[model samples]
Target: MMRRYFQCLADRDAPAALRLCTELVEAGRSPVDVLLDVVAPAQHEVGRRWAAGEWTVAHEHAATAISESVAIALGARIPQPDPARGHVVLACAEREWHGLPARLVGFALQEAGWRTTFLGASTPPTQFARFLDDADADAVAISCSVAAALPAARRMIDASRETGLPVLVGGGAFGRDDTRAKALGATAWAPDARAAVRALESIAPPPAGPSVNRRAGIDEHAELVLRFAEFRDSARRRWAAVIGEDAATPLADDALDHALHSLSAALLTDDSRLLREADEWLSELYSARGGPSCAVPALWSALRAVVGEPLPEASRHLGLLRQVGRSAPRLI
Candidate 1:
């Protein structure tokens, strides 16, 4: 049944997919089960396929829109119980535009009999804090889809903590085998919506420590950040020189920005594994966007030459890009 629903989504048949879910509910399947078991898996697969270059961004976006609609429909079908447990605020980190994970968690919270305020995507910290000021929330659940948004997440987490709100952090940004949330001062971490719901049920707020700037704490990372800023300016000027004058297009700009963002995020953890993984994913994403693989090699080499010996990860990443360039489509 889930596979059938996924097919409906891939076919862009929102109505049919909704109908299938409606029938599942009519047949005594719990709405929450359908959400967790059906909608969630389908959305995950959609993301995976997109990353694997099996589907275009348009197809992924269409499927996600339909899934968001389905989540709303399911929320309507499921009765919201009184706030017997507690009131919770759900939001994605600032600039983290993917909200489906937060949405699903909101629905799950509602099912668990908690009053939830879902702030949706790209919720600014000040704006979210303002909202929290007026509302009575026991906990805040922050969803971040990208590692690049962790700085924003840290800001939100700090703001929430100022109000004595216990924060539960979860998302793909943390990657596997990492404690990014706790490292950022979160009360607890939840890897998924189900775990988020459970975490909210029973989580003790940790003792607050003096707020620290995560980026400025590490000497090497701080230096790298400064070097990257200078390198970015040089790369822009030299882009036309290396890739041709026509190579300074938006696609090229986006690829460079992506590389910088990923590398910066990886700097936070100083994890070599994460740096390599991020570059691998970025290479795949760049290719998926029809970005020339040559751009990856070009950008990495430029950064290496400009930044000097400070960032060794750039060398490792450049190796990956060179391998990618070997088999990728030629520049147009």
Candidate 2:
């Protein structure tokens, strides 16, 4: 039943997907089950297919749009309890644009009888605090889908604690376990919607402490990231120009954006492993597209030049990127 709905989503048939969802609901399937089981898995598959290059960004977007519609519909159909379980707020960490996962969790909580206020995506710490100022939320759940947003999550948790609300943090950024979330000072970590509900139910009141302003520690590569930012546009322009000269069909804006995003991700973490993975992914993507041999190298070189004096990790990534380019496929 879920498979057919997923197929409709993949085909970009929103009406069919909605019809399938309606049928499931009419057939006595739980709306929460539809959300957690059907829509969630379908969206996950869409992302998985995108990562594996089986689907383009467009396909992923189309699928996600359908799933989001289903999620909203499911939320509307779920009957709200009279008294409500409790009040909680859900928000994505600052700069975290991936909101669907958080939205699903919010819907799940709502279905479970919690009065949930979902703040949507990329919510800044100030905005989070401002929202808490007037609203009487029992707890706050911060979502971060990327490792890069961990710092923001930490600050959000701290801010929530200041408001006398126990903070429950979740999302992929916390890893398979709650270790990272615990380290970030969250009262509890919920890996999924069920766990989230449990955490909220058993949440203890915030410890009596001063309402001090706590900020996440400064990122180690902040300076390096700023340097990269200074020349980010220059790098993208150079990459496109090089790709244009070398390939019959120039690389798409999406591809160039991905290249810059990969570079930024590596810069953010100061992790050599991420840079290596980015290099490999870009190399393979270019190879599959049969783009110029110079494309990858040109990008790395432009990056290195922008850095002026490379940081220790930057040098390693630059070396790795150069190695990747040497074997990159060239268009005849």
Candidate 3:
């Protein structure tokens, strides 16, 4: 039953996650086990597919929200031991309002016998700093799904370090540059939130010895940098025009997430002209701006990543803008 449930999530089938959770509850399947195995692994699976472009961001989110809701249903059933190895504070950077991963980390950490404070995304840096000072957490784990929020992640890391707080940063951006993780002042970076639990355990007793490693030969992404720049800016302009500023600044996760997946049919079209058009359209997008739009920098960053090495800061800024998608509902 759990195996079938896992398959549904891998397929990004929302109804399956929810229905399976209900059945598992009825069948005496430990909610804790369901979340530990069924939800996290499934979430990771969907995330992997989304990265490979096999699934749209919307489908990934649908899978996430459904799984999160199920995890929430499990509730206090998540393990919580008084004798924890250490405590961690998890939050998203300001301007980055996605929090589903942090929420998942909160549950996953509990299962690992570590205490965690699930701080949702877009939290002000000042308040985040205060929380660390007050809570005296063993380490602070910051997350961001959108690449645009990375600078904010850097700021949070800087602020935490000023107070001697051990910090680890993770998310989509980290997926782009594991080395930039430390460059941003993070004590370390994890491929995923669950991996963070292992990172924390492996670090040591004090949990504050900061180690920075440069993953040599990790400096460039030619195609992403050169090819993606113009196209990314264009996409941002289209997104901004479609959603407008108010909706664009604080993107509607549900709407944008929905749009990404709904467009999968486009990905299925094999016409070379259509694909060429897609590529060319990105190049011409908002050409009047003279560069990539300010909205989706991460796409720019990820693109530059393909360019590899000697990546200038200007390129990162451009890529970050492309990370913003058409998440808002069109204002007709």
Candidate 4:
């Protein structure tokens, strides 16, 4: 069933995908089961294919649109449940544009008997807080997919807590464990929607207390944010010099921006693993695209050079990444 649905996605056949799901539901499968078992895994494959360069970005987007449509369609077919489990508001972190995961969580919660309101993608902290003002929500759930959005997740957590609501955080940004979630002062962390449902079953509003201080290297992160444009200009120039190009292509420029964002996230979290993982992913992406082997190294060098004296911590992190790069098997 997964393979057939994936083919439907690959073929961009939304109707076929919806029919497949409908067929499953008619066969006595739960709508939520179809969603979790079929749609969710298919979407994961979409990401995997995109990362492996097996599908173009446009192809991935089209497939994702189909999957989202299927999820929404399945959601409507779910028999309305009592809001007996209390209300939960779900949102994606600011600058975190991927909302599908959060949407899945919202639907999963609905299936689990919780009334939910999904705020969609890129919700600002102030905006989130404003909504909570009139909302009778029992708790808030935040989903973030990238490390760069961790700071925004932290801000959202703060906003939820300010209203005496505990924040339940999940998604790729929090890693495979609660380390980052706890670091950001989230009330609880769940790896996925099922885990989230279980976590919320035991969740309570946090006690009134002072906020956790997770800003050990925040000054460097702030510096990166403050001088981002200047650093970009410098990195661009350095990249051209090292790569023997007059200017970077749009894709290369986007990669550079992502690299810098990862650096900023590393500094903000005081975790070098973020940078290491990013470097590894980019290396794989570049290799898959048949890009030059030096591209990733040159990117790191350019970022390192631009980092210079002002951001010693970021520089140190980049140095660690470079070491990892050297020791790892050459992707290209």
Candidate 5:
């Protein structure tokens, strides 16, 4: 069934994908099972294929659109339990464009009897705060899928806590655990929708208290952010000079932006693991694409060179990454 569903996604057959899910539910499979078991794993496979260069970005996007349609259809088919549980509002972190994960959580919460409102992708902090003013929500759940969005996640958590609401954060950005979530002062962290429901069950509205403060390194992060464009352009030019203009494609540009964002996120959290994870992922991705072994190192070297003298902290972080790259096992 899963293999057939993957073919439907690969073929961009929305109707077939929806039909497959519908058939599963009609066959006495729970909608939640079909979603978490079938649709979610299918999406993960989609990502794997894309990262392995077996599918184009267009293919991934098209498949994701079909998956979203299927999720919505499956959600609508779910017989709503009476809204006995309190309301929960779910939003993706600002600048975090991945909304499907959050949407899945919302559906799971709804099935579990919580009243859920999903404010789709890339929800800004100010706008999210305004929504809470009228929402009367019991708790806020923020979803983030990338390290780049950690700062925004912190702001969203702050917004929720300011309203005396405990925030439940989940998704890839927090790593495999709640350490980063704790660093950001989130009320709780759950790894997935199932865990999120359980975590929220344990949390209640907190008493009025001082607002959660942003962590240290804000100043250095700000400095890096201010010069990001300068750093990006310098890295691009240097990379082009060394690797040829033809090699500096938009994908390469995205790699540079991702690196810088990961770096900034690392600096913000005082965690080198964040950057290392990003580095390892990029290295594996390049390796999978049959990119030259030198590609990742060259890009990092260019970034390190252009980070310049004014930002010693950023340079130091890059220097550490350089050492790691040297000693780390190379992908074959």
Candidate 6:
């Protein structure tokens, strides 16, 4: 099964991966085996290839699309228990397109027996709140792939709380920093879906990790996003100073690109060519500097998530999506 998955990756065949996965399941492979062994491994390999420049951004995106479809198929086969694994609605802020990690979390929870309701990438806050009420989910989880998306993630969690749903934070936005998670009033920081189940063991417990990602206010999300970015930049600068660009070259060329791309995929579109270009950026930084990439495909997904792309009149409401965070009153 694992070999079949690798074959798909080497061939850059998303559809082939899905077909092979289905066949393996019929052959009695456990869904868990498919995910832990086949699905996750193939995705990781694709990432490895992209970082090494063996694969282009386009190739990576195709691979992710195929892998996600297989995950969905495998998830469907999991015997969903009654009451629906405590309904979980997964999404990212309107400006955030990193949905792969969130999907992984969603799938993990779904397979763990949660009735997962995935809103996919670039979900508008207005709709996100509505989904919570409509789905009457037990909890709402937001994934942020970059610091820029932190403001949006904070708002989604805040709005999700109006209905009194427990808001959970995951993804790169919270990766190098958990304090932002606390400051945003996130009930918990799950890191990933598997961790989410543990994080949500009950209602938001007394934030056990750092205690800054949560707070009380309206625009607080935006303030946190700014602070998050400032902090990330500062941390990065300090690290650069200490390591000196020359010494960090290898890591910049390899690992950092992979990490940043991972950050982008969770923060940007899964199929984003822009995220893969993070490697190009890394190449420049390392020339001598380095960077990183997933998610489901959405029509106008990247445009909706990032700035610069002008939307058609029909998508004007898409701007409302960012309003959720922009409207959030900042904390002192």
Provide the overall lDDT of each model, using Cα atoms, as 2-decimal numbers. 0.75, 0.71, 0.56, 0.84, 0.83, 0.57
Over all chains combined, what TM-score does candidate 4 have? 0.93
State the lDDT of candidate 6 residue by residue for 177-198, as single tens digits.
4555656668778655567778
Identify the runs in model 4 with alpha carbons over 4 angstroms from their true place: 207-214, 323-332
Instruction: Give TM per candidate.
Output: 0.82, 0.71, 0.55, 0.93, 0.91, 0.61
RMSD values for the candidates in order, in angstroms, are 4.5, 5.6, 11.9, 2.4, 2.7, 13.3
Candidate 2 structure, TM-score to reference: 0.71
The worst-scoring run of ten residues by lDDT in candidate 2 lies at 211-220
lDDT of 4 by residue, 1-332 (tens): 99999999999999999999999999999888888889989999999899888999999999989988988988997656764678899999999988888998988899889889999999998998899999999999999988778888888898888899989999887777887677677889999889999999987887676445646367888888899999999988888886666236765776788889888877766677777777878778778877777777788888887785788888888877645645244221
> Candidate 3, TM-score vs. the true structure?
0.55
- Across 173-254, the per-residue lDDT of candidate 1 in tens digits comes to 8666436676677888887878878888788765776444454324544565677667687766665567675457776676
Clashing pairs in 2: none
Model 1: residue 210 alpha-carbon error in angstroms: 2.5
Better of 4 and 6 by TM-score: 4
lDDT of 3 by residue, 1-332 (tens): 55676687767676767778778766887665566566776666776666455677787777777777777777566667689877788899886766776776667677788888888769888888878778868878898765445546766887777777677777754544455575565777787646877777765332343332232212222223343445344544555553356224423232233222112111111111222222223333323223334333233223334323443432333333333334112111
Candidates 1 and 4 compared: the better one by TM-score is: 4
Model 1 misplacement above 4 A: 52-54, 211-229, 236-251, 269-273, 286-298, 308-332
Ranking by TM-score: 4, 5, 1, 2, 6, 3
How many clashes in each structure? 0, 0, 33, 0, 0, 37
Runs in model 3 with CA error above 4 Å? 1-19, 22-33, 40-64, 204-332
Write down the lDDT that model 4 would get.
Answer: 0.84
Worst 10 residues of 1 by lDDT: 323-332
Selected candidate, larger TM-score, 3 vs 4 = 4
